[model samples]
Target chain A: MSAISIQQIVKTFPGKHSVVALDHVDLLVESGELFGIIGPDGAGKTTLFRIIATLLLADEGTATLRGMDVVRDYKKIRKVIGYMPGKFSLYQDLTVEENIQFFATLFLTSLEENYDLIKDIYVQLEPFKDRKAGKLSGGMKQKLALCCALIHRPDVLLLDEPTTGVDPVSRKEFWEMLGRLKTSGMTIVVSTPYMDEAVLCDRIALMQTGKILQTDTPQGIIDSYALQLLAIGGDHLYDTLQLLRHFEGTANCFAFGDKLHLSLKDNSYSAASVTAYLEKNGRTDTTVEPIQPGIEDCFMAYL
Target chain B: MRVLLFLLVKEFQQIFRNPAIIRIIFIMPAVQLLVLPLAADYEVKNVYITVVDNDHSSYSHALVNKLVASDYFVLTGYADSYAQAMLDIEQDRSDLIIEIPGQFERTLVREDKATVSIAANAVNGAKGGIGASYAASLIQDFNTDIRTDWLQLPRYNPYPVIAITGSNWYNLHMRYDLFMVPGILVILLTMVGSFLASINIVYEKEVGTIEQINVSPIRKYQFILGKLIPFWIIGFVVLTIGLVISRVAYGIIPEGSFGLIYLFAAVYLLAFLGIGLLLSTYADTQQQAMFISFFLMMIFILMGGLYTSIDSMPEWAQVIAHLNPVTYFIEVMRMVVMKGSTFADIRSQFFIISGMAVFFNVWAVLNYRKRN
Candidate 1:
């Protein structure tokens, strides 16, 4: 059975300034597959997540979790899905253990029943089980929320922007935990604005303005770039980018770190040819190389 | 049911964890019941009056003496002219000025009628109105006294006067505290019950923990019941503490069945807590719930006949008081405490509040959408 499937779900918020939050959005995640919804803020990623979690009703379509309709069979859907909202939503006044137990009881399960699933995370939080969740640092709060979300032994987990605001160390640990969870065969659908994290997903759908721009494996998306690209670095990186955008042969020129990812109008322009052109324009110190596209390169190409 | 029990446990843990809230739960009812009744007096007294006796006649003096004699009015001064009376009023020594017209006694003997003008400071309308009515009743008594004293006319028997012979059955002393304590207790219960339900849930909503709960498979009614049961139980604990304090400090005991009061109180709290839950369901923030509950509590207390008699209010206000749940609770309390009224005597109140309980709880639960 497919772990999650959404069919042309449309949702619009009615207000003084009516916003079409979701517009004919659709997706299907295979069982046990780790899928990522990559988008910036207000890209309707959260809206789609909430609908799939059965917390919100779609205005115009249907979603199903493991064959249970999100609208018609929402109760069963709720039992089978673990949803961690975009916001840190654990009770701040509650102790860490209490929050876990509460969420466990909500699913008619117990911590002992699902310890194996959350052992790695809960073990780190054990010393502070007596401490209130609010007093925990950002990383600890994230871990507690994750534990609570997983305590029910859910068949699927929906994590919306779980690592949006965390230190680099914590972000790495969070993905590692996700990697372990993925291996356990529980379907995971997580969203993040970080394009670098997109490569970690088995497959990702790039979303913007309530639309999925593309859905593919990271390498597949990178390999599908049709234009020949060159990475160019020079003595003056900013000046090179300015000249490259207006260059007659330049199709796309954007700064990627210390260099520029430049796609040329002509596939015949080699690194030597571009270097010779920049050299004539007083950018004498330049290094140019043909390079493969990263997920960011593909994302900027689509944008 | 297990989910409900867990939710209830969570609510209690959160409430008990806050020492200040727990302190208030136990202490507030006791303090309010003990302190509020002493100052919440409805019977007006000590209305200061300045009499301008321009007639200077025996009848005018008799009227002045009558005003002085009634405990309701204090004779602040006697002036020969209206200007002096106005001066007395300006000085704030008197709230009212009684101007007996010239030849006040001759007119009564010859024409058989006399007019006395009463002017009162109406800035504080409620106080001023009560004072004026008290003075009017005193003067009416004096007129009757004169007819019996010196007129020598055979008492008219066109309609026999029926003295009310009002027996203030249970509270024979008519202590304001006895009447007000029970009403004040109901007010406190409503405020605590509604505020607890509204603010507690709204706090969760504001902090977004409610979102976590909303996404769960919990039934809507179960969620509402769990939220309400904690505060509902606390409300009754307060009622029990309030009753004990009322008995010990004020010597009040219910003449009616204790079981009936408890039953009515349970239903009253159910209805009130439902109102609180409904408010919170519509509110997305703690501040909004608090202000809305506060506004409703104010209306309930002021119109529920806690410190004011519903009968004395205008017709429209009386109809509104009839609809207010707090008013029914206060009335039932008075009937049970003061009149020893049985449940049979207050079946309407019981049915009305039970209906309210069902209506409000259903409304609250329906409005609380798990799939928001």
Candidate 2:
């Protein structure tokens, strides 16, 4: 059985006119996979996470974790799942040791009991145990939050945008820590708006506007791209982008770094035809190459 | 129980760690309790009087001396005419005008009858009413003395009569502080209890920490009790400190059972704190909770019978006072402190407050859900 399975879950927020926050969403995470739910803001990602964590009720259909019904087995699920919300929410006035100890004791466990589970992260936090959680740097606060969530040694962890606002170095360290945890055989589900982090997950579900656009392994998602993509590099990248958009067979074209990635309406269009067309249009020193799709390319294709 | 213990430890740490909150909860109430009672006195005193003695007789002068000696009135001046006395009162110079008529001593000795007109500035009605009564009683005492001296004549017969006496119970000197301080302390305690409890949960909700607790295995009642218990203990500590100050500053002590007074206070705090928590649940921000608490606090304190006697209130207002938990505590304080009342004496108040405690706390707990 899947560790977490969801089917046709629907959620709406009441307002002047009701807002459908989640429209017929479905997801499944196997026993021990680092699954990423990739979406921009307002995509049913948070709504889905909240439902699976038993913090909210779906307006329709059902979801379960380890074969326990979410609605009926809420108490049991609360014991098994660790949830870290999007914001830095640990008590600002509390010292780091106190916050971790509080969450540990809340789960009817002690810090000493889970020392092995959180010791690596706590090593960085140990020296500053007396400092208030709010007084810590952004990276330290992020680590402390992760430690508190993990103190109970939960079987499944749900992290909502954990590294949304952190230095690049800290974000790298955070992901490395998650990688270690996954290797130790704990199932984790994380959500982020950054498309680059999709490759870090074992599997990913791309979501937009309350709908799941696609779900697959990161490599599979890139390989499944149906459009013939070409990266054309030359002088004046912006000018090349506008020139490519005016091409008769161009389906979509956008600037990517120093080049413009262009896809055609027909896969039969030759790369030499594109090079000849660019040279005729006063472009110089142009290099054209067929490229395999990245996750962002796949996401843009789906859009 | 273990979960509750840890939550309590966390709560107490947060509460004590903020030096501003500690100062607000600890130092401010004690100082206000010490100083507010003396400043909030409402006893009738120093009634300024202008004597308009038209006759200028020995009897009139004697009555004026008696009024001055009673210490209730200060004779500011003897007006030459009633118009002068009216001007004095209108100008806020005097509160009462005692006008001695022309017949003065002649009518009293010959006809055994006389009349005097006393005009009072009734803008401050309590002072006016009290001052007029004091002057009337003193003049009557002087008349009786004159009759006694007249009876010393050889053939005069002593009249058989009845005299009435009164005793002021609970407060013999009618010290307003003894009555007011306990009531004000109840207001202060209620303000502290409800304000702190109201802000507690909303603060967590605003900071997003409540979402963490919401997803935990902590029971709903455990979470609420964990939040309220810290403030519940603080409320009692505040009361104990207030009571000690009441004793040291005003020489006031509970005349009834000390155990009974504390029992009533505990129940009262429970009711106010529960309402505060209920407000917190309905508010998404601390500012919203503060406004809602302020709105409720206004109604609770005004209808609480702290300053005015409930018995004197309008029929509807008195009916509303029955619903206020603060009213019961204030009444219990007076009954226990001044009247030396026992449990049986305040049995009705006890039952009502116990019912309020159960109603408010159960309502608060029931509305508090672990899920959004």
Candidate 3:
């Protein structure tokens, strides 16, 4: 059985107009794999994480961690699964050492018993052992929260947007820590809105609104793009974009940083033809080239 | 048990780390205890009076002197007309106005009849009601004095007068502090117990820390007890501080056994702390918890019969008072302190409060949901 399996899970928040936070979602994570759920804000990533963590009940269908039902065997699941909420949930008044000790004790284990599992992350936090969790920098707080979550040496870990709101350098280091934890025979399911981070996961599910648009390895997703993609760059990029939108055989065109990524409908479009077309529209200094698509390009394609 | 121990440690660490909480725990009790009983004095004194003496005779002057000497009334000023004295009442300068008629002792000597009208500002009901009765009784004494002086004294006079001598029980000197301090201590204990406990869990919810607790392996009862035990200990600490202050500062020692008061306070804290925790579960934010706790505290303190007698309340109000956990605690506190009542005296109150404690705590624990 997979470490975590969710089948036809549906959750809706009640209101005058009910919001479907999770609409028939299904997921499977193999043991010892780093899986990521990639989506933007309001994409229901936190709601899904909360459901699998057993903090919430799905409106329909069932979810299980290690083949134990989330609703019926919640007590058994709680023992083996560690959840770090999207928000920084540690007590701000507690010292770093105290926070680790508190969560460890709650899981019926001590830091000393599972010190090896969290030693790497806790090492960075040790210098600030006496510092209150609230007074730490954003990076340090995330690291401390990670240490608290991992101190119990659980079989599965669920982190919701752990690296969000951190400096780029700290975010990179946080992913590296998760990479190491992935190899420790623990099923790690994490979520992030940063599309670039999708490449670091073993597999990723691209989510939009409340539905998963596509789920595959980053390379597999890029390889599955059927349209011919071309990058168009020149002066007056906004005007270039508007001009390209009316161009014949143009399937879809959107700005990607400094270049406009243009896909063709069929063999009727070519790079030379696009360049000639732009120059015909009073655009002389223009560059058109076919480049490999990244995870973001695939995500945009899926959108 | 170990999980509860660690939870308590974490709670105490957090409580002591916040400087504001430390200051509140110690300073609030001292300030409220020192100020509340003194300000909430029931015995009204220094009642400002405006006397409109239309009679310029010695009888009117003598009545005014009696009022001045009684220590209860402070003669603000003597007004020339009844309308002038009415201004004093309207301006809140005087609580009562006495209008002496122009009989000038003639009505008393000739026909043994006279009249004096009293107008009191009933805005402050206690001061006005008590002050008016004091003035009327003083005038009655003056009337008897005049009649005695006018009549030929018979050494063995034959009018049978029923004289009733009464002894004040529980409080010989009728010290208001003796009556008020213990009840105020109950309020202090209630504030520390209920208000603090109510806001504790909700604050965690606001800060998102409750999500961590919800996802953990801790049992529901263990979590509830963890939140409760710390405040339960704080309740005793506040009670101890109040008792010490009452004994040293106000010179009030419980006439009954200290064991009985502590026993009652222990159960009382559990009942209301359970209420505070129950409120905590229902509220999503600390502000909501605080407002709901404030509403309940107002009802508990007001209907608890601290300031007014439960016996004097309306039938419906009396029912609410009996239903209130605070009413029983206040009654027991007064009984133990003022009347020196033993366990046997307050046994029914003890059982009722114990029942309330069980009911509130069981309800609170069952209502607190880890998943929701």
TM-score of chain A of each: 0.95, 0.95, 0.97
Task: Give the poorly placed runs of model 2, Cα more than 4 Å off.
Answer: A230-248, A255-261, A268-292, B46-164
Better of 1 and 3 by lDDT: 3
Rank list by TM-score: 3, 1, 2
Task: Give the alpha carbon lDDT tens digit for every residue of A234-259 in model 3.
Answer: 78999999999999978888999999
Top-TM-score structure, candidate number: 3
Clashing pairs in 2: none
Fraction of native A-B contacts kept, per candidate: 0.90, 0.88, 0.96
Runs of candidate 1 exceeding 4 Å displacement = A232-240, A270-289, B51-70, B74-80, B100-117, B133-167, B311-318
Report how far residue A257 has shifted in candidate 2, in Å: 5.4
- Per-residue lDDT of candidate 2, residues A1-303 (tens digit): 788999998899998988898899888999999999998888878889889999899999899998989899999999999999889999999999999988888899989999998888999999999999999999999999999999899999999999899888999899999999998788999999988889999999999888888999999998888778899987788888888889887888877788788887786686888888888998868899988878887777756
lDDT of 3 at B238: 88
Each predicted complex: what DockQ?
A: 0.67, 0.70, 0.91
Clashing pairs in 3: none
Interface RMSD of every predicted model, in angstroms:
1.1, 0.8, 0.7
**DockQ rank, highest first?**
3, 2, 1
* Reference-based TM-score, model 2: 0.88
